[model samples]
Target chain A: MQVTMCPERAIMEHVTSRWAVLVLQLLSNGEAWRFSELRRELEIVSEKMLTQTLRTLERDGFVHREVRPVIPPHVEYTLTPLGKGAANHLVALAQWIKANHPEVAQAQQHYDAS
Target chain B: MQVTMCPERAIMEHVTSRWAVLVLQLLSNGEAWRFSELRRELEIVSEKMLTQTLRTLERDGFVHREVRPVIPPHVEYTLTPLGKGAANHLVALAQWIKANHPEVAQAQQHYDAS
Candidate 1:
């Protein structure tokens, strides 16, 4: 694989990445999330991974990052219009996977047996 | 990340993978593809990678592989009904990425400049 992927593919990869999917799904709820709050919600995500995922999504225009000039200058993340558009599709895909889990599990069992 | 991924996340990863996305999009046209034909269509895909992707999809029940009994046996791969369901969503995502390429490009340029 080439070191630098095409922009479209790269963006697709970014949006569909494991962490990105979860992040997008959460942000789609229309509530702006503080960085710490998001980390709390996503229990398994490392702080470093979450930060990198947010930066990538922000660069891709799917996320809006705002640094609130509060006591400590907290950062809030929300889905941009473009991000919401992408998130809708990703959320649907995630739902589909959830709904079809049984079918896929059966398939895996059959595949492993043969 | 754990060596063994959750089933739903793993399935999501399999379907959205770069080569898998292209493969599903191509197969969604309702054509069964010979391995060589797919290799030809996806010019940059390595033979090993394509083979591995196909096996993964097949095991996941998203792809059906059939072997023709002849002088020289040829294996053909097609999307299963489940595969088609996933492919429809994937193809839509790919189209979305293509259509929104310019917006994303501008965002990247702006991001790079800052």
Candidate 2:
């Protein structure tokens, strides 16, 4: 079935996407980082996936990518005002996960053992 | 490289999953719903997807599925205490989406028209 084609839903899906969430969370640390820096920080993300995720977030107006016209390429990403708002919510979720990781861990063990 | 093998991350991924987000949001209304009732409420979700989402949530201790031994089959679902907590966070995000949908729409329009 064709779901309602709403931009709002599309944007949310993009931001809350698996890779998108990690990218946003990383940016919430209040430091602007270059593309490669972000890739290193995320560690497990593929170069292709990171590029694709950043492009989507930039398209949604939640990310700002700046390129410095220098000898070597230097592109940095920062959250836009709207991106900051989304990141605020995402950070809350992230902190919750960090604090309650043990509970979630126990639950998973129980599930696996059952 | 292998990412950290933590059940916490796994459970979070499950609950914050695409279909899982919608399912949790629906259950936040404080009413128990049958499996099919939820599928109808979500509208765009497939039976297989809904069942898979519910099973994951149940396995994580965030959802309770009770089966009634009737002539046919009757299975109902509700949030557990932990599930309620997760649902609370999800409802906040959902409400944010509902309220700011217009802004998101505007952003998307600009993105598309650009």
Candidate 3:
């Protein structure tokens, strides 16, 4: 399926993406995180998806990826100022969901019942 | 494909959805909008997607839908307080994207070049 690409559409899709938002939220709090570290932090994420999400975010300039020249190769990910701005909003959204999960759950139950 | 459903996951997906964030942001600024009015406001959205997004947001209690008994049917959508909270954050994210689109586009061009 060809997903039509528009600038607004792309940005919305990127930020609200399943793993992208979580990755941004995590990096926002931590400042920087290594690839494996991020994978471990978000246990449910697959390696492929994590890598893909990071690349997409990096391409969008919201994420900065630093590769360290080493024997084993180390990569670190952090947010750019633009990303930090996005992450700040994401954190607020995440916090809201965490704080109001109960009410949302109740509403969902009611919705399902009716 | 059956996507695994989790509350946090669902909430993130719902708010970050293509039309949902835009709709929430619009409602946040205007308080309430009729269905057709919203479609007119956001010229790119399809009626099916708009209704689907509204249903999802309503189920989550972030959006409140009011139905007025009239000849042609009048349904107005506004952010619930919970939704208002979410919208506040979404607006911040949207603003960031708008402000930074140029840089992001430049970055995408750079990425495509190499």
Task: Output per-candidate TM-scores for chain A, rounded to 2 decimals.
Answer: 0.90, 0.87, 0.88
- Local error of candidate 3 at residue A91 (angstroms): 1.0
Task: Rank candidates, lDDT, best first.
Answer: 1, 3, 2
lDDT of 2 by residue, B1-114 (tens): 112225545665776788887788777777788988888877788889998999888877788888888979799899887787777776666666666667666766788897
Docking class of 2: acceptable
**How high is the lDDT of residue A88 in model 2?**
71
Of 2 and 3, the candidate ahead on TM-score is 2
lDDT of 3 by residue, A4-41 (tens): 23686578679888888888888887467899988887
**Fraction of the true interface contacts (Cα pairs closer than 8 Å across chains) found in each model:** 0.47, 0.26, 0.55
Best prediction by TM-score: 1
Please give each candidate's TM-score. 0.89, 0.87, 0.84
Cα lDDT of model 1 by residue, A60-98, tens digit: 989999989999688899999999989888878877887
lDDT string for model 2 (A1-114, tens) is: 112225545665786787787788778777787998888877788999999999888877788888978889799899887787787776676666666667766776898898
Cα lDDT for residue A19, candidate 3 = 88
Output the TM-score of candidate 2. 0.87
Clashes of 2: 0
